[model samples]
Target: MPSKTSIFLTGATGAVLTRLLNHPSSNTFDITVLVRNADKANILRTKFGIKTVVGTHQELDKVESLAEGAHVVINLAEADNVPFMKAILSGLRKRQAKLGDPPLLIHTSGTGLLADDARGEYITDVIYDDLNVEQYKSIPDTAVHRNVDLLVINADIEGYARTYIIPPSTIYGIAKHALVDAGVSNPHSIQIPVIIEASLARKHAGVVGKGKSFWPDVHIDDIADLYVVLYDTIVANPENVGHGWEGLFFGENGEHSWYQISKAIGEAMVTLGICTGPEPTPFTKEETEKYFGSEQWGWYSSILPREPGACLGMEADVHH
Candidate 1:
């Protein structure tokens, strides 16, 4: 029998990765996940029947060793961790040297790299095109995730690895997977929940500034299927899909302004008796930091890409 393609995956406990593992195409590939907690690793091993490596992404040597054994490396962990990416690229380079074939690296980035400093005051007219190689190259290295994106692109340019980046914006919906059922995976996404919790706590939907900042959105399953489609495309024929600069696939179906979402949340809160007001309220900078965490308030207050290219033809089945 022919051997299954080996895939080394990080962020096994995350929502997107968990849903990707649950996809039916996952059975065709040999997937080994890197997990930090020993008990979660055990559950993923015995329950899901996939290989497990007990280590964090911070462990450079361990990460390098694992990447050396895989035909593909999917990094769903920290997007901007330079050292972690460097270690993976180093291992993939060694593997390329030994096997005389370049391996594939699929990195998860965010559309926040396309963000502008609107600060929730107004929306920008610029739309990011994934197919525009020159436009993508023009993104400043100082942007949130561009440094790591550049690292992957440079590796692809050096001919050691074929690299693709999926930059998803505001992923929603609960993840359905065996790991989630086995009490191992985190089934929920991040941004919307922060809005909800903060709203419930303060008894009004929280908005940052004028809340005019908008971002694209995608369902959990729809985005997961994009990953599957990319994997299948790569396995079928590497030439069929673009790598490096041309390989950025933005995962988004629709767009929503922060004000629109917050108003809906406020209405829902009033209906559910969680809050008395049906109108959204603005959050102070300090309150935003306190409720949404110091790091995440910027996203709520800033404009992400108004239009992200859906290069692939996958239609999102779920809606807001």
Candidate 2:
């Protein structure tokens, strides 16, 4: 019988990772998760039969210790948490040095790194493809989500770990994971949920500027499938696995404009009697920040133009 792969996971409570943990194939792995609260972790532990370590990103030592023993370390936490990443990499490095076998590190990033400050008023033709080496390298360091991704890629290049970066576009749709089977409904994604909240608060659905900005979108289930495929591919042929920045992956099914999104929200609100009309309202940048807060202002307001040619490549590979 084949031995079970030991997988160490962080951000197990998150939407994408939650779906991953509940995947039927995940049962083949001996999984351990690092969660902030033991009580909160119990649900997944019971439903998925995975072990848990109680800790947060702030507890670097504990995180490193947990990561050191795994064949795969999957990080779905904050993309910009450099200190936490460094700690995980350090632990993986120590293990690699001792065993002479590098473990796979699957890290989450987002297409938001390629976002432009359009404030939903305009669209650009500049699109990035992961398969295009020159275009991928052309991404500036100043990009919103670039720093942490660079750190992980550089670590892989330095032989600390075999790292893969999954940069998903805006994710939508309800999640169906082990927790759901155990009677827990996963929270909605940030964009639509915040828009709904703002609409309810202000008595109308609103969009930033002209709301012309566009972003790629994918279903939560599709995103989960990508994770499973990538994990299996890496474990099966670590020798042929892509290295460093070359391991970047993206997931996008289709693209939508913010105007269309807001219009749908407005129409829904009107149908539900939450609003008087279906006409979408426009909010200035200041108004957007006021409603969604400064931290998420860009997420709801900025234009993130991404091409899914690379994602399509992966989809074809997985399906065929």
- RMSDs, each prediction? 5.1, 5.1
Regions of model 1 farther than 4 Å from truth? 14-28, 295-320
Which is the leading candidate under TM-score?
Answer: 1
Backbone clash tally for model 2?
A: 0
Q: In each prediction, how many residue pairs overlap at the backbone (N, C-alpha, C within less than 3 A)? A: 0, 0
Residue-wise C-alpha lDDT for candidate 2, range 1-320, written one tens digit per residue: 23777788887765555655655676677888887777767876776676888778899898788888887898876677788888888889988897888888998887766666676667766767777666777889986568888889888889868999887776788775556656533555555666667767788878766777777777877876787788878867877766686887887778877778778989998999887897777764566567655534534332222211111101111101
The digit string of per-residue lDDT tens for model 1 on 173-269 reads 8987666788887787777776778788888888766777777788987887888788879878889899998898988898877788789999999
Model 1 alpha-carbon miss at residue 67, Å: 0.7
**Stretches of candidate 2 above 4 Å error?**
14-28, 183-187, 295-320
How many angstroms is residue 178 displaced in model 2 relative to the true structure, after the best TM-score fit? 2.5
Query: In candidate 2, which residue pairs get closer than 3 Å at backbone N, Cα or C atoms, i.e. clash?
Result: none
